[model samples]
Target: MYIEVGQYLGQDGVWLKNDETRLFIQAFGGMTPEFSRKMRSQTRDYWLNAHWMPHFKAPFSGRMDNDDPEQRAYWQVELLRQAAGTFPCAPAFGPGTDNIPTHGDTANNVWSLASARLVDSGGESYAKAVWHLAGEFELLKYQKTDYLRQGDSSHYMVMTVENNHDDAVPINMAWHTTLGSPFVERGCWLLDNCQQYQVCPQGTEFDTTASLELGARFESLSDIPTRTGGKSDLSLMPGYNGHADFISGVSSSRQLLWSACYNPYYNLVYVSVIPLAQLEDQVSPSFMNYWIHSGGREMMPWADYDGGCDRNYALGLECAIGGSCKGYEWSRENPQLLNKPTYFELAGNSTASFVCINSFFSPEGYGRPITGESQLTEMIEQHIRSLDISFDGLQAR
Candidate 1:
């Protein structure tokens, strides 16, 4: 039952045949322009063209950087590095060049797949697999119980790094997802738990404030927890709420169901030679634990698209082993800058997980955050099972 979802980068992104039974659903090429409007209507349950994203080159458009004939092509091509430009709804996991890899073959540079499966000696599907682009990126692969409901009974998705590159290069990354129209055109909102956030201006003239809002530096899982004041940080819970109220969407106002982003382990080295470096202490890998970072589970509003919907029709759930932004890197020689984010070589045997859960709810009762490590993990697994059952019902048709 494979179908054509949409197009991307002049290519095609097709929906897989067994997507209903697969852990995840991924489209290839670029997200089509018609996706936004279609998603709002219940006349159709699933949308092959359910998402859309603007080209990343818009930020550098008509600038002197585009003046040079060679540079123009470079920027044009490198722009795809931002996953948002290609897939309207996609997450940036792991690490590597924030700007698309201008040095590599831009055609194959983007590898956004829904889910992967590994086979055993008998060639039977053994364990499910998710994508981890390049060695620089590091994300945990887990299931999204609360957000999407479709596809498989073991329905799950976790952003992780595949470490498929040979070069050692600096990298910056985050999940970039542009929900389909009606969601974007009508505008969506966000609710996040992070306490501190910086307006990331990627050299764009457009008022980014309208497009994004960040949370303050968070200290723990709950709204209140042991504040992290010392060098060492503890792995806290993951969750957040939308500020003010839910954003209105075209069809119905939506809210974050459940979200979690945690990296339990990290590989780091704080260089001491750099006198003015902020991270003068030893770069203990423990600090990079997903449970320790500021933004765990969050609910945010997107004032950028359509008008301004607080429901967060489209959301970008992110988790990283290292700081995505440069200034936050505690170590002078930030390990996240490397193409190979860690030496773990997350091949067939490494164990890591990145989980984001979103459940739709009425404006009345708000969602809660998950704190205890064991408890949160268990809850997520249960939600994954629930989603599987729901998807099965849809597939029975």
Candidate 2:
């Protein structure tokens, strides 16, 4: 299987990678022609965009060249020669919370004019496809379904949102994902196991199984522990959420649960699998939620070879619908964040199904994340069931 969608750097993205590992598992963003505004690039393509991360934090912070320390070493050596995955959650998927959300929830309309049509991968994966995005969702005929496949090392996503509109649509899904682990240098953790756990802004609680690292571990920028601990917590420990202030923690398991973000001395991992009752909407009650982008420049430089060191650092994830879901009428008025947001409902015309699993690991397979011996999140679900990229009758344009 050798999959390729079209137009890289120019935007409308999708690429699987094989011509001897081009090193992309999923990709998007075409440099010009308005680039669909999906990740809302501008500010000079957010300083030459390529997953630059919806303006590097919060309603698009855009750091106006952060006091030109040589343009932050020329934009961290051009974001390691062009971003794709480390922009992480600019708008890859939304409704997790930027506060005034709910327009496609975020990511510039959840990847606005984005389009991918490989369909017929129902033929069995080389990169089966069906990706379209355009959701305002007020009246309710909105659309955004991303059904993709390509396994054998994993990448299977099925994000469906169909309202068809008879009226009754207020679900704020989430996948505001992010991971550019490269060499996370022994930081980033979350695996408090789960039957239910909530580790946010210091509202601590666990039931056993813990490994929660990362609340700011810069490695450079003078190793930012919130600038030599002058207060402002940066949060991972030591009292929880602070860096810029925005912390989220969740863990719930009725079985089929997972929420990972690992870099244990650079073993590398990014696994997300949670069936969560086929992803909520039996009328609310979803699970999984781990968001912490830590405001005010925690780590926003990509690495300019030693003198500046590699950058494009990142951290953000959402097993989502795990609630208190930060807004949208306050996650629809709490009831425990509306039973924790993973939303699931279609039955007016028909169509309601959900599944999730996103994987990317490196046990010296050369994707980075070195120094391994297994147990880095259990080898990322053993390469996500050995890339078992099977779609199993997925349909919903």
Candidate 3:
């Protein structure tokens, strides 16, 4: 395995690569220079800015004039929607603290590289690195370790959060993995083991053209209810049709949770796997959040209606441990629908860890979906065995 370190959107990031594929891990912000410029070009009068911009005196700051607790809370919830990360990134949402930034301190602050090196075990080589970041209030610390093996496409990651306070604290976090461009074309299919799904109640606020029904429930992603009394085949990514939608669901398999995006045109698939049983007890009720942006947002950075760019075509397959991306309060209030607790309590002076694998590979056949837990596990095992990598603890159930 080879490692390349650099800065991504002003935050420390690293790229882990082998002969087969590569994966990038970075701090929350994944904005490109062009995207940043376009974000800055939006007028203050736009609905997005008008509703929340006045609350913050500066970018990514808590300084605000509003004394009302409700207004302040609204600001925190809206921050990530306005400015979020792209590609594979971690965005830690609440324990619902006012002092913390929108996506917690980890998302807003830059992380420092603690260590990086290559290890040789059983004649097999792999790369490992540790990255750390401290919260603004210094109450919690974030650490992430990445493992990439030679000649393997899969990248394994372990993320830990330590509570510095004397008392226990609640935490909510997720991996905001995104796919775009050639990999997410018109015919791409989203394959998952989720048994149920609920449409996001909060639709894209700036997207006036959005058509998905809020709070709708479905049994599969392939057939989702729409606002127009029609069923949408969400499994297949459609052409730019000026629409956007969000949905959240839970996988039926608790042992191994997985989702794959298969692009028939490229004969490639990007898979994200989370071994839920391997994670700490503090992380429970794992959920998958799917966000589709197809030229619906007409504000500032996503002015798709203006026709200069088609930057809004992307899919976010976020693997989360709490209630979708909703903050702590919303998650707590809406637990009945999800049938699981949206937040977990972490003991003081203790650390809770979560693990996941993100990989990119070309499948043997065209347009064949990787279905069921057994098949997914077999594919991962085969890939690892082919690389001659011995990952003992992560065996398939």
Candidate 4:
């Protein structure tokens, strides 16, 4: 077990050890176990057990019996058989559904409050280093905020990685999170303020297209001002309606944030974030990042979810910044072969920001209708400026 206290952020968090084992995050006041075993088991079975058949494995199994339906059917059956238990199946995995590889061999760093105690949740109480990559990149800085009206409760987990080599580097990153018991059940409701959707290749199974406009289109719009205070079961918007994929810019910039939110009072979970890229299209070694909030007496504010889960009395707000180990360079040079990597280079080092706030209810109760994009963008920019000012103040301290 490793205990790390991010004093500058004014909060504490934890982390668990091992690249292929369990991880528990307490910064957001939630605990979850890693399901890599199941992920790996399914991935391995897909590759070795499926026997690609007519597709062939080259030197080992060269296109055996091209016209054999028995062989093709066998391959199809094997694919479906393996998919029975695999997650993110078609919409998230695409043609590589059964054979999709794990994001990395393991999970990456998840940002939260002051100190994250990476520990063993299985009663071991082991404390591990929250920044296992500390040797590679020092905690350049940490920032905290109480944007959710939780009275110093909300937190923003930020870590800046500088190029140690004194030279420019390319990287791709994604925030992969696993939530424990009590996940969102099927037929539950979800809501999003995204005016547009960016369909990733992987999400094509759910909905092949994407959009960029949002407005008043809820099956039941309430005047509630927060998620916790609002009614359950919201409707999908006209067009761009599906699960496992969300409005692209939701967690980044001012467009969108948190991938999903839950009405714990009603036991109804809502996932509003989706994969922005596909497994086959993803560039190697990208970094996934987002935010998290928990331990509140009522509904929590919105958080990001580039990866990870919002679960177990907690919400995991993940965002994919870039990659580690100069992997983004690989993506940059091979843009045609890579997934939808953010064009950070477009704005250079100007510092871009994305914000997701999970309120107990929408702003409708405040006498404001769901103005979607216009209101969302305004709020995001405000928060970003506030954080910048806060960071400036922290430096003075």
Could you give candidate 2's per-residue lDDT for residues 1-397 as a string of tens digits?
4445554433434554322222232232211111111111235221111122433222221222656676655444332223334222211123334432321332333244345444454455444444444444442333333333433333455555556656455455455445432322224554433433333322222111112332332222112233234433222212122222233444444545565655544444556664445433322225455444322233344222433322334454455553333433444555353234433334454434344555545555544443442355456555655554233434422
TM-scores of all predicted structures: 0.38, 0.29, 0.75, 0.35
Give the 10-residue window scoring lowest on summed lDDT in candidate 4. 84-93
Query: What is each predicted model's overall lDDT from 0 to 1?
Result: 0.27, 0.38, 0.58, 0.26
The parts of candidate 2 lying over 4 Å away from their true place are 1-152, 175-260, 271-316, 319-323, 326-329, 333-357, 367-397
User: Residue 9, candidate 2: how far off, in angstroms?
Assistant: 46
Error at 224, model 3, angstroms = 1.3
lDDT of 4: 0.26
Task: State which candidate, 1 or 2, has the greater lDDT.
Answer: 2
Which stretches in model 4 have alpha-carbon errors above 4 Å?
1-132, 135-153, 177-183, 202-318, 322-330, 333-397
Q: Root-mean-square deviation of each candidate, in angstroms? A: 14.5, 21.2, 9.4, 16.8
Predicted structure 1: lDDT: 0.27
Evaluate model 3: give its lDDT: 0.58
Instruction: Give the per-residue lDDT of model 1 (tens digit) for 1-397.
Output: 2333434343433332233221123322122223211112336444333233433323322222545675444334433422341121112222224532221121123344454333233222233332323321233222211122233222222332223334432222222223222222211222232323222223222122222222223333233222133321222222222221111111010211223332222110000000011121111111121111111112111222234333322223332323333222222244532222421223443332232222222111115443445544454434434442222232211
TM-score of predicted structure 2: 0.29
Q: lDDT per residue, candidate 4, 1-397, as tens digits?
A: 2233432112233333332222223232121221111112424631111001111111221233537775554333222211110111000111211222222211212334433433333232323222222212212221222111111112222223333343333333333332322332232233333332221322222232212111112222222122234332222212112222222223232323443333322332223232222122222212222111121111111112223222112223334443211223333543431233542332223221222222122222235443454454344333333332222222211
